[model samples]
Target: MLRQNLQQKLLQKLSPQQIQFIKLLQVPTVALDTRIKEELEENPALEDPSLMTADEPVSEYDDLNERDDYDSEAKEDTSTDEFNVEDYLQDDNTNDYSTSYNNGDDDEEKKETPIAIESTFFESLQEQLDLVPLSDTDFIVGKQIIGSLDDDGYLRRPITSMIDDLAFSQNVIVEEEDVHEMLKVIQSFDPPGIAASDLQECLTLQLKRKDVNNPIIKKAISIVEHHLDEFTRKHYDKLEKSVGLNSEELKEVVAEILRLNPKPGDSNQVTTKQLQIIPDFHISNNDGILILTLNSKNAPELRVSRSYMDMFDHYDKAAQKDKKLKEAVQFVKQKLDSAKWFIDAIKQRQQTLLKTMNAIMHYQYEYFLTADERKMRPMILKDIADKIGMDISTVSRVANSKYVQTEFGTFLLKSFFSEAIQTENGEEVSNKEVKKILEDCIGNEDKRRPLADEKLTEILKERGYNIARRTVAKYREQMNIPVARLRKEL
Candidate 1:
């Protein structure tokens, strides 16, 4: 059983450097600066080229000088020679040698303190809580409850459970009613419906806060609470007959109901608006041609520090005379090498991102220009990989967490790629396009007698899209559109 086994097997494996390169390729230009700063702080080998000097000898620093081909302003310091890559390699096997580029250079020694802002949800909530006039116990309880509330601001756990947890964990005996009272106070906080027990309660709470005088709204709440089945099933005819309301009246009620805020907690989380998707690359339309420009603001100009490089050069040159100087040089070299890898990683990331996005833009040129779902053609990871001559996994990595802003809207890079479906006219269209058409058809349909999947399929065929009934049904469900019978209203 323990005998040496040899078998021919095909496998695809990536080294640490290769994996790092792929990751760096996807990072957009705007984020690249922060990423660089982080690297400078972590790696001693990395230096800021802005701080280079005439005294530093960079001739012997061959490895770093080669990277200078990208941004040549910064010179390498060739002073102390003792510090080298081998020392750091031997000192810590666990440390990623490439990740140590923390500080930039000796000249730019002092780092300006960053202005801290409210970044956490709880921090924002606590700040808002300070503005309120609740009792100390209530505030303490509220803070705990607020902390427990997720990004959506839903109090997921039961009050009794939380009360028990508090009593047991904090050794503070608190009644369930006290927790419940505090929760109600929190629910009244800026988010309007933060501490509701369930979806129905959440919606109802927000609706009740409104001073609108509409019996339809009152009935809508009743319907959502008790006759939710009737509302969801769209058994409007029966419900109308029972509730004594006609079709037009029901539509008016539905419209008002639609206007109510579903996620009140989201209203206060305004920081998301600040997160701008600074496109890593810009593609403009020229005279019947597409022009591409890499957004340079996002891409930083960086170089190794001259002082660091000079120290190493001097140490190396004077190693015969001074042993201490040689060790200092060795240390600086180790830090600088790390710094170089980080800078290299940053450069590599930009190239990969550009290459992948360019390929995608070309692949779905119509969709990028128009921003219409119908214009989107069927594309896959394999298709892009083939186009870019890169591995499918590499393409996938580029697609993941990457976004592109277009004239139409900002969308995740991966959303443009979908499987193709054949139309009755023997032409191919994206499944996404088909879904869009299906949604449009549903939105404009007669609620009195909603079209079934079979009917929808027939309609598509009439429009030159040859799709099966099951496919139509699948698309409907995927779009969150109900069944024909369920979709029918009064």
Candidate 2:
């Protein structure tokens, strides 16, 4: 049964424009160009102002308005369409999209950075595989083995699974012995340890290729082959006893083992890992004053298509208003509305990013003026959100994946925010400062006997900054510093 009741309730929802703004806000400057290009391809009513022809006038709506004035006799019949069309473009260049339509002298040319191309890990292995003369069946097995290797160059797939894949995909059946033989051949390829299934095998493969005649190489091979557990645990005393080598001999063996490539496949990743970081904001220190400017690339020149406006005008004044004409008019209306929403979203995105970065710059003014991180104060998403009169999620969206370039270096916007940790005197400081202190202490420590988290905590206590041992360990781990045992050297 259907039921109806009178009720009062409040519902909150984001409009289409708000949702678009949120998505565009989180996109970093590096990815924004591709996003805008995608929108241009999808929406016929939107066009890049820079792509406009030299002879074409920028705005056609002005002439259309004049044309409507001249057609006073027909204007009465087309009042609804005319009013809607005019209202759609009323905020034309005067309000929204001023970054593209206005902002003279600030506009600059956008240039793309070129990246160098290099061979992939699998491709390099394939070249070596090609040089090894084999039967067509063996060659297919080798290709399948190379294809199974991950980016780290490790073939984690079991032979049975690969055999099934070959049967299903390539319709080539091979025995387990054939696959193992091919794997051994590829493992012997250049940059030794390429196809080893595990780290022990990988290291053993690399060590075997070294000076076998040298006594130290033999001892190193023995340590890896038998006493690998002791070697990895850094139990130097036990390693010396197990391998029957004195301190100097064990040291030499350990040194020989240290030089092996753990991830041999990553050598080919040099070309593929070349990620470009385009900063969203640029902060400069001029005569003791900090100035923050958004990257001009973030402010692309986008506008509604003048041809689309003319087409709407033609459709609106057509004498024959058929079904097809009505459908065309509705389609054009949807496109125009979408274009307007997109342009307005871009404008709001610009304002929001500037406001957010401006607030962050002022809040950390001392840190920006002087590149010392100690000058940075504790700041969180709420701080900026409140200062900018926006939601915390909005501020978070602006900060996420965004970067800023200063004299010191380019840094992620998220780096500036940290939880407040109070000093003994009740003065609040950024956890970044604590992390920096931890990094410095670890950097200048005695590797023979590294400072444990407890000692680090005591040192902080002596300096009038009280924090627990666990907190110190947390900070140490955050900076990728190992514990006392792992940090010790021979």
lDDT of each: 0.68, 0.84
Task: Name the best candidate (by lDDT).
Answer: 2
What does candidate 1 score on TM?
A: 0.69
lDDT tens string, model 2, 1-490?
9999999999999888888888999899888989999999999898887776899876655655455444666656666543466655453565334354232254243445667777767878889888988999899999998888888888899999999999999899888998898888988997788888889988989988888989999998888888888888899999877778898888788888898989998877656455889888888888998878777777777877766877776787787889999899888878888888888888888888889999999999999988888889999999999998999999888787899999999999899999999999999999988888888888899998899999999988887789999899888888888899988887
The global Cα lDDT (0 to 1) of model 1 is 0.68
Candidate 1 lDDT tens digits, 342-405: 5567666656677888899888887666667899889999999998788898888778767766
State in Å the error of residue 346, model 2. Answer: 0.6
Off by over 4 Å in 2: 1-3, 55-62, 65-84, 88-109, 160-179, 270-274, 317-323
Which candidate tops TM-score?
A: 2
Off by over 4 Å in 1: 1-16, 28-30, 49-195, 200-225, 267-276, 319-330, 366-375, 424-426, 477-490
Give all TM-scores, in the order shown: 0.69, 0.89
Minimal lDDT window, size 10, model 2: 95-104
Clashes of 2: 0
